[model samples]
Target chain A: MRRPDHQTTTLTAEAVLAPYLREQAASFLRGLRLQREHSAPADAGTQRADEAARALRHAARRISGTLHTFRGALEPVWADQLRAELAWLSGTLAREHAYATRLGRLLDALHQLSGASLPAARPPSGEGASETDKERAALGVGAARAGALLERRLTLARTRAHSAALQALGSSRFHAVADAVALLASEVPLSPSAAEPAGLVLHAPAELAEQRMLDAVAALPPDEAVEPYNEAHDALWHQARQLLRLHRYAHELLRGAPDPALVGPGHALDLHRDAAEAAAAASAAARTPRIAPATAYALGVLHADQRHEVEAARGVFRETWPHAAAVTAS
Target chain B: MRRPDHQTTTLTAEAVLAPYLREQAASFLRGLRLQREHSAPADAGTQRADEAARALRHAARRISGTLHTFRGALEPVWADQLRAELAWLSGTLAREHAYATRLGRLLDALHQLSGASLPAARPPSGEGASETDKERAALGVGAARAGALLERRLTLARTRAHSAALQALGSSRFHAVADAVALLASEVPLSPSAAEPAGLVLHAPAELAEQRMLDAVAALPPDEAVEPYNEAHDALWHQARQLLRLHRYAHELLRGAPDPALVGPGHALDLHRDAAEAAAAASAAARTPRIAPATAYALGVLHADQRHEVEAARGVFRETWPHAAAVTAS
Candidate 1:
C-alpha cells in the first residue's frame, strides 16, 4: 500500500494497518483466481500457475508476518488462529518449490560435471586438451545413473508436494482461512491498543522484533569455532533468518517500507537458508538405499559444495553484523 | 517460437531458422518499446524497465547464440556482423544488472551480519542471550560506514551502466543492427549451404560445437590439482560455459528446444560466472584507497563468500559433466 503523505505520528493503528490487511487478502483471492483460471488442477503446472503461487505466497507471508509482529495491537485469539492458518498455507505452498529448487541444483551439478558432450575415453597426453579428456572420461562414469536417481527421487517428492498443495488449496481448512481473510479485508479485529497513534503504538513491538533477531544472530558460534558444514550452526542461522524476516516485517509496519538497513541482510539470510536446505537434500539423496558408489560420491560432492556455500554466507553475515549494530546505535 | 511438430529432416535450414529469428527480432523491438514508454529516461529505473531489460537481453542472446551456432547454414558475413552487434547490445545492457546484483549481494551480506536491530552494547556473559548481545555490538562497529562505501561505489557503477545502456540503445550502430534484424524477419540472408536439408547440414556444426566444449572441459587440470578459487580455472570454466551455450543453441537449431542435456549445466555455469564476478567486485571494493580497516575486513569477507560460491558452482559442474558426456556419446 502507498504511504500516507501526512506524518505517521498523527495516524491511528487502524488507519495504517487495515488497508494493508485488506490489500493482502484481496491479493490472495486474485492469486487464487489467476491460478485456477490459468491452469488445470490436475495438470503438471505452468509458468502462470507458478507466478500465481508466488503472489499467493507473498501475500500470505506479509499477512502472517504482520499478524505475528503486531499481535499486541490486535485481538489475540483471532490473530493467533489466522496466523496459524496462514502458516499452514505458506508451508504447504513452499514444499513444491523447495523440492524443485533442490532437484534443479543437484541435477545441474551433475550435468556440469558430466561430459555428455565429450567423446569416449581417449589416451592421456601431457597437453591441456588430453588432460581434460581424461578427467571428463573419469568423471563421466555413472553420471547418467546418478542424474536418474536424483531426478526420480526429487521429482517424486516434488509431485507429492504439488498434490498436497493442490489438495490443501481445495480443502475446507483453506476455505475457512480464505473466508477469514476475506472478512479481514472488510474488518480487521483490532484491540484497545489500535486506538493509539500508529507510530507510538507500533514502536515497541517493532523494537522487540529487532531485539529478537539481534539476540539470535549474536548467539551463533564464532565462524572459526564452528566446524565446516556444521548442521547445528546451520539450523541456528536458519532460525536467525526467520527472526530477521520478522524484524523486517515489523520495520515495514513502522516505516511503510522495509527497513533498508535490514533488506540486504534479509536477502543474504534467504540465500543461507536455501543453501542449507539444498545441502540437506543432497545428504538425503546420498543416503538412498544401495545406490552405486559413484552416484554416492557425486552426491557427497554436491553436499560438500552446498555446505561450503553455507559457510560462505555465514562469513558474510559475520562481516556485515557491524553495520547492523551501528544502525541500531544511531 | 512455438515448435513445429513435423520431423526436422524434411525442413530446409532457412525454413526452420527464419521464423525463429523473426520472432526474436520482433520480441526485441517490443521490449524496446515497452522500456521507452514505461519510464522516463532521466528517472531512476522501475520494475517495468527491469522487465523490459530482461526481455531485451533474452532476445539479444537468442539471436546472437543462434547466429553463432547456425553460421554454416547462413550468409557468413551478414551473420557475423549481426552477431557482433547483438553481443555489443547484450554486454552493454548487462552491466547495470551486474552492478545492481553485486551491490545487492554485498549490501545484503553486510545487513545480515550487522547488529542494527540490537542494543548498542552489553557486558559479556556466558549465557546465550548475553553472548548474542555482546557479539552483536562487536560486529556492528563501522558496519554503517562500510555499507556506505560499498553503496556509493556500486550505485555509481550501476548508474554508469544504465547510461551506457541507454546511449547504446539510441546509437546508430544499434539502429543499423535493428534494421538488419527487421529485414531478416522478411528475407533471411541465406548461403548456398542453406539449400541442404536442415538436419543434414546442421549436425556436424552442432557436433563440432559440442566437441569444442568437450575439448575445453578436457583441457582443465584435475579438480584436486586446481587449487580452490583458482582464477585461471574459473576463466576456463567461463569459456567452457560459452562453448556449452554454443552447443546448446546448435542443438536447439536442430531440435525444436534446447538440449535437455545441457540446460542444467548451463544454469550452473551462469551461477559460476555471477559468483566469480561478484567476488571480483568485492575484492575491488576492499581495495578502495583510505578506507577504514573494519570496512576492508567486511569487504574481504564478502569477497571470500563469493569466491566460495564460485568454487561450489565449479564442484557442481564437475559432478554434472559426465551426464553431458553421456548425451554427447549417444
Candidate 2:
C-alpha cells in the first residue's frame, strides 16, 4: 500500500484529535456503564459488558497513544497526568479482561488444533469417527475442564478489576478526567507547534515506532530459544511487545485509514506479542506448586505448545518486518 | 431425522460389533505408537501426540461400550474383566485429554462471544471497521491472556496423561487387554445365545438403553435448577451422561441405518449430555478456593452461564423426547 501523504496525515491528526478524544472519552464512559451493569442483577449477559470493558481499555490506550503521537501539540504536564489516569483505568479493566480472554484464546486454539490433528487417531468405523472427528470430540470434553479452571481464576481477577474500576470512578482524578473530557477542546493547552501545517503526525509516529521495533529486535540475544526462560529473554520480549503495541496504536491513529500494508503486520505483531505472553504463562503455570500431578502434566504440555508457538511467532515477525519496512521506506 | 427401521438396525449391530472391536483395538495400537513418538527425541508436535492420547481413550470407550451393548454374546467373566481394564485405560487417557479439550472449548466460546459481544466497547473509530469489529480486536487481546492461563494448566495435565499412558502400556492389565484383542475372534467363551438370530440384538439394547436414560433422568430432582450443586445432582448427571453414551453407541450400531426417529434425539441427547457435564464442571470450578476475588467472580459468571445452558438443554430434551416418543410409539 502506498504511504499515506504526510501533508494530509498532519491535517488528519489536527482535525481528528478533539473529536477523537471526545469519542474515546465517550467510549470509556460507555464501557464504565456496562461494567456497572454486569455487577448488577439484570441479565444483560456478559457479552455486552465484556465489550464495554474492552472498549474502555482500547479507548484509554488510544488516548495515551494519541497524547504520545501528538505530544508537541498539548501542554506537557497535563498530557502526562491525563495519560497516567487513563492508563490506570485501562490497566484496571485490562486485569480481568486479559485473563479471561487468554483463557478463551488458548482453549479455542487447542480445539482448533484438534480439528486437523492426529490422523492416526482415526477410530475404526464400526465404532466411531475418523481421526480428528473423534479426537475433536474427546478434546471437547477435556477443553471443558480446562475452561472451568480458567473461569475460576478469571472470575477472581475480574472481581478485583471491577473493584479497582469502582474506586477509580469515584476518585478525584476521575472527576478531573470527566471535567477535562467535557472541556477537551478548550482545556488542552495548545502550543504554537499545534498549528504546524506540514503534518508529520502520522509519519512521525510511524517512523518512531519502526525504529523502536528495530532496536528491540537488535537487543535480542542471537538465540532466544537457547534460554528463553531467563529474565533477560522475558524482559526483552516484553520491551518488543510494548514497541509493537506502540506501532499498532500509531497505525490506529490513521483512524482505520492506514496504508494497506500496515494492516497485516498489525495482526501479525499482535500474534507475536500474544504468543510470547502465552509461553510465559505456560512456564509460570508449570512452577505453581501443589497442583495435582495430572494438572501439572497438562500444564507442561501447554507450556511446550506455547513455547513452540512463541518461536514460530518470532519467526513470523522476522519475516513480516522486512516487508513492512520496505513498504514504509518508500 | 426419522427413526431408523429396527429391522435394518438389528442387522447393522451384528455386522458392526466384530469390526468395531477390531477397529477399536487398531486405534488403540496406533495411538500407542504416536504416544511413544512424542516422548522420543525428535519433535513430533503435541498435536499428533494429543490426538493419539484421545484415540486411546475412544478406543477403550468403544471396546467397553460394545462389550456392554452385546453382553449376552460374550463370556460373562471375560467381558467383565475386559470392561474393567478398558475402563481403567480409558479413564487414564481421559484424565489428560478432558482437561486439554475443556480448556480449548471454553476459550474458543469466549472469543466467539467476544466478537459479537461487548457492544458497549464500540470504539469511536474513523477506521474502516464497525463497532463489533473494533471491539472484537480489543477483546482479542484479553482473550489472548485468558488463553495463556489455560495453556499453562493444560500442559501440566497432558504431561501427566502421557506419563500415565506410558505406564499403562507397560502394565499387566494392559498386556491382558492386548492379548484379548489379539485372540478376540478365536476366544472360546461364546455362548450358544450368540447365534440366537437378530431378534434380541437391536431392540433389546435400544430398549435397555432408553430405559436406563429415562431412569437416570427421572432420578434428577424435580427442578434441577433449584439446586444442581449437591452430590446427588452430580451423581445423577454422571449416570445420565453414561446412559446417554450407551444410547449413542446403540444408535451408532445402526449407522446411517438408524431408526429414522432416533437420529434427531440422538444429536439432541449428545448436546444434552455435554451441557450438563459442562455445568457440573463450572460448578466445581466455582467451588475451588483461594482464587482471586476477580477470578471467583469470573467463575461465577461461567457457572451461571453453564447452568443456563444446562437448563436449556434440559428444556431441549423435554421438547425432543416427546416427539421421539410419539414417533417411536407409532
Candidate 3:
C-alpha cells in the first residue's frame, strides 16, 4: 500500500485521517483484485496476487500503527473499535505475506549469489558462434533441477497462505473492518480537543510517539548484559526490535515531516532480530531431541555463524549509534 | 599475494616469473613476522597472526596456480615437484582461511541486518540525554557472550592452521621448494622450446590452455540431465567446477592479455563448487547415523538452500557465458 498522501492544502485532523483511511482502502481494493479473476476459488500462483496480499498486510499494519499513535486525536470509541478490526485483517494476511516474501527473498539471493559466468550475448555476426553458444547453454544442467524443488515447496506454502487469506476475506469481521475504513475518508470522528486546533493535534502526537520509542529503547537491557551467549539477552533484544518497529510506524503517520531517528535506527535492530532467529533455528536444530552428530555439527556451524554476526552487529552499533556519536562530537 | 604485475618494460618469461616469486616471498615474510613477535610458541588469539596465516595461504595458492599454468617455462622435473610442494603448503593455509573468512562474512551480515532503533546522535542539549546514552550502551549484553564463543572456536582453528604452516616451513621439503623458487630469479633452467622465442613461449600454451578449458566445459553434462533430486547430478556439476578451476589457473599464466571467456566464466563454476560443498556439508549433517527429525529437518533446509544456489549458478551460466562474444570479438 502507498504511504499516506499528506499533500493536502489543509492539515486538519480530518485531512490527516483521510489520507490514512485512503491508504487502507487502496490496499483492500488490491486484495479484492487478486480474487476477481476466479468465481469459486483463488489462485496464489500469480505474481500479482502475491504482491496484493503483501500490500494488504502492509496497509493493515500501518492503519493499526497509526491508531496506536494517535488514538487521542480521534473519537476514542470509534478509534478503539476500528483498531481491533484492523488487527484481525492484518493477522489474516500475515501468513501469506511471510511465506511468499521468504520464498521470493531466498530465490533472489540464490540468483545473486549463484554467481553467473560470462553471459553469452548473441553476436550480430556468423552462425558458428550461435552453435557453440547453444552447446554451452546445454551445460547448465544442475540449475534446472534445483529450481524445480524450490518451486514445488514454496508454491505449496504460498497457496496454503492464500487460501487462508481468501477464507478470512469472506468472513463478516473483515467486512466490518472494510466498512469502518471506508467511512473514515468522508465522515471522520475527531475529538473535541483535536477539532479546535490543527497544529496541536498532529504535532504533539508525532513528538510523543518519538518520545515513547526512546522510552522503550531505554527499558531494554543494557549492551553489557545482552551478551551473545546469554539466552535472556535475545528476548530483550527482540523486545527492543518490536519497540523500534512501533516507532517506525508512528513516524510513517507523520511522513511529511520525517524523523530520521524514529525510522532508520529501527533498521539496526532488524539485524538483531535476524541473528536471534538464526540462532534460535540453529538451537532448535541442535536440540532436536536425539540429534545426529552430523546434524549437531552443522547446527554448531550455523550457531557460530549467527553468534559471530551478533557480535559484529553490536560492534557496528557501538560505532554508529547516535548516542555514541553525540558523545564523540561533543 | 597480488596477481602477477604485467605492466612491465619488457614482458619476458623471466620478467613475469620474477615478480610472481617476489610476491610469494613478500607474503611468506609477513607470515614469519607474525610468529617472530613471540619468543615462545605462536598464539592464534592475536588478530594479526590470523591475518598473516590467511595472507600466507593466498600467496601459496597463486604460486601453485602459476606453476601449473607455466610448467613448460622451467625444467619439467623441477616444476612438477615444486608444484606439488606448493600445493601442500597452500592446503595447510586454506583450512584457516576458510574458517576465518566464513566467520567474518557471517558476522558482517548480522550487523547489516540487525534492526536497531534510535541511532542516538548528539544527546539533546541536556544532562538527561547523556544519562540515557550511558544506560543504552550498557544494554548490548547478548552480543558479548556470542562474540566470546566465536572467538574461542575460530581462534582455535586459526591456531591449528598456523601450527601446521610452521611445521611445514621447518621441514626439508619446504626448504627445497624455497630454494627452487630462489634459483628461479637468477639461474633459470628453460625448456629449449620455450627458449627459442619469447612470443612463441607465451602464445602456444595460452592457445592450448584456452582450448583445453573449452573442451572441459563441453565435456560437462547438458542442463536437462542435471536434476537437483538426483544425487548423481551433483557429482557431474562438481567435476565441471574442478575443470573450470583448472581453466581459470591456466589463464592466470597469461593475465597480461586476459580472456574474459577464460577468467570470469569460471566464477559461475565457483558458485557451483560452493553449492556442492554446502550441499555435501548438509548431507553429512543429515546422515548423522541416528539423526533426529528436527536435526534432519534443519539439515534438509540447509541442503535445499545450497541446492537452490547450484540451480541459480547454472541459470546464470546459461545467461552470461560469452560464447557469442568470443567469436564476435575474434
Candidate 4:
C-alpha cells in the first residue's frame, strides 16, 4: 500500500550523491591550478609591486579559506586531492624562497627609486642637513657601493619570486578552486527546485492523522493524566489493527505461487505457520489478564501525567491486556 | 629579532586541535546511544507504550542528525562512525517484525481497558435505524481497526524516514547548503586580542632595513617572456639574493660562532652557494643585451593594456637592466 515512486527514490539518491560530486569537482580543479600558470602581480611600482605581492598572498589565503569551507561539500574521493593541493599552497606561501625574494626586491626597489640624487662630496649645508649629514654622506657612498654589489642579488631575488608565483599558478590548486567556484555558481540556482521531489515523497497523510491524535490527547487536563494516556493507548491500538489488516491484505495479494526468490527458502510457509501461532498466542494471552475499565483509566492517567512508572504501565498493557481481550472475544 | 609570542602559537595549535576533539566527543555520544538500555523502550499500555517508543526513536534520530552535522564541521574522522550508526538504524527500520510486535502489544492493551466497546452483533431492522446509522456502524468498526494498525505502522515508517534523512546529511552536502552556518559552528574563532607573533616578527622594520639593497633590484620590471624558463631564471636569481642577505644578517647576528648545523649540510649548503652564484649570474646577465628603455616601456604597456606576450617582456627585464633603481633605494 505504501508505494513510493521512482522520482522520489531518485531524488533521495541525488541528495546523497551531490556532496560527493561537489568535492570531486573541487579537488580536480585544485589539481588543475597547480599544474597551470596564473599568478597576477599586484602593480608596477616598487612599493605597489610589493603591495601587489602582498595582495596576491592575501588572495592565496582567501582561496585556502574558501577551499577549507568547501571541502565538506566535495565528494570524499576528491577531498583528499583537494586537501593535498590546498595544503601545499598554504605551506609554500608560508616558507617559499621565491615569495621572500619578491617581497625583498619590491622593498629594495622602492628605497632606490624614490629619492633625490646625492653628490659624492663633503656634506652640503641644507636646512635638514647637519652633523648627521656628514655621517649620512659617508654611509650613503658605502651604501651605493653595497647597492651595486647587491644588484646581482636583487635580480636573482626577483627571478625566484616570479618563478614561485608562476609555479603556484600552474599547479593543480588553481583549477580545483576554479571548478569549485563554478559548481557553486551553477548549483546554487537549482537548490529550491531540487528540494521539491524529496518534499513530495516524504509528504504522508499519516502525519496529519497522528497530529490530530496528539492534539486530542494534549487537550486533556493535566490532572486527568489517565484520560490522555487512555486516548493515546486506544489511538495506538487502532493503528496496530490497521497495520495488521494491511499486512494481511498484502499477504493475501502475494500468497498464491509467490516467486521462491521473492519469499526466500520456505519463508512463505513459515509465515503462514507463524500467523496461526500468533493468533493462538494472542487468544491464550487474552485469557489471563483482563484489563478492568478502572485500571485502563489509571494507566492513561499515569501516562498523561508523565509518571516515571509510565513504562511499567505500558508493560502491563502490552503483556496483559491484549491476551485478555482475545480470550474474552473468543 | 623575529620573536613570536607563546599565546599566538598556542591559539593556532588550539585552532587545529578543536575539530579533532569535537569529533571524538560526538563519536562517544553516538556510541552511548547505541548501547542496549540507553535507547531501549519502556513497558506500558500498547498505545501509550507505542507513543513512548516512537518518542524515543524520534529523540535518537535528532541526536543522530546533530552528530552527523557536527562530524561535517568538526572532524571528517567520525564520518565512518556516523555512517555506520545511520546504516544500522536504517536496516533495523526496514524490517517489519522489529518494531511491529512491540507496537501491536501496546495498542491491544489500550483497546481492552478503554471501555469503548464495539457492537457484538447486528440487530434486526428497527424504527430508530436509518441509512446514517448503518453507515456509521459499518465505518466505525473499520475505522477503529485501521487506526489501530496505523499506530504501529506509522512508527516504523517514520523511523525509516528518519534513517533516510540521516543518510542524506552528508558533510559536503550540508556545507554546500549552509557554509556560513557550518563555519560558525565548527571553526574555532580567534579572539580579537590574540597575539600575531608571526606577523610581528616578519614585518619588523629593522629586518626590512637589513635587506634593503636586494629589495631594490627586485622591483625592476621584466623585459623578457614570462614563461617558466625565464621565470625560473628570475626566481633563482631573486632567491639567491634573498638567501645571501639572510645569510649575511644571520652571520652578523651570530658573529664568529655561527652554527654550521643551523646553516644545514650537503644539499642545503650547496643550495646557499648556488644561490650566490645565481645572484652573480643575474647581475652579469643584467649588463648584457639590454632591452632599450622604450622597448621595456612598450612591453610594460602591452602587459598592462593588451595583456599580450607578458612573459616575453618579463624575460627581457630579467636578462637586461642592472637591478632597478627601486632595489637600490628601498
Best by TM-score: 1
Writing each residue's lDDT as its tens digit, candidate 3 over A32-139 gives 555444313444446666566666666667677677777888788988888888887777677665555545543442332222443233332344344333322321
- Write the residue-wise lDDT of candidate 4 on B1-330 in tens digits: 222234323443333224333443344333323422222334222454344334434433433443332233323444445445544553443333343443443344334323255333222334223432432332234234433443534475546644453444334543242232233235533332223332232223223433543453444333332211122233333443444344333232212222232333223333323332222222221122332222211111111111111232333334443433223212
Candidate 4 wrongly placed segments (more than 4 Å): A1-60, A67-81, A90-131, A149-151, A164-330, B1-330
lDDT tens digits, residue span B1-330, model 1? 435534556887777778778878888888878876764665446888889888988888888888887888889999999999888888988888889987887677667556444333232333434433433343345356667987899899998988888788789998897798788767788788787787677666777888888888887657642234344356577788888887776666666687666766788899988887776665555446565544544453455456666766877877766643635522
In candidate 2 the C-alpha lDDT for residue B11 amounts to: 55
Cα lDDT for residue B79, model 4?
43
Each model's lDDT comes to 0.70, 0.55, 0.53, 0.33
For candidate 4, lDDT tens digit of each residue in A82-151?
4466556545543433434433432343233112233222222342234234323322332343334334
What is the docking quality class of candidate 4? incorrect
Candidate 3 local lDDT, B1-330, one digit each (tens): 333434322356665554555656566556645644531364544677656666666566656666666678767787778779778766865665665654453344223222134442333334434433332232222223233334555567666876776687678987786676666544556566554443446555555555655565565556741234233344455555555554555455445433466445567777765665545444443443453444343344344445555666776765667665333211
lDDT of 4 at A123: 21
Better of 1 and 4 by TM-score: 1
Second chain of candidate 1: TM-score? 0.88
How accurate locally is residue B246 in candidate 3, as Cα lDDT from 0 to 100?
A: 49
lDDT string for model 2 (B48-155, tens) is: 766776777766776788788777766768888888877887787676666665666656544543343432212223331342243234334433543454455556
3 versus 4: better TM-score goes to: 3
- In model 3, how large is the Cα lDDT of residue A309? 56
**lDDT: worst 10-residue window of model 2 chain A:** A119-128
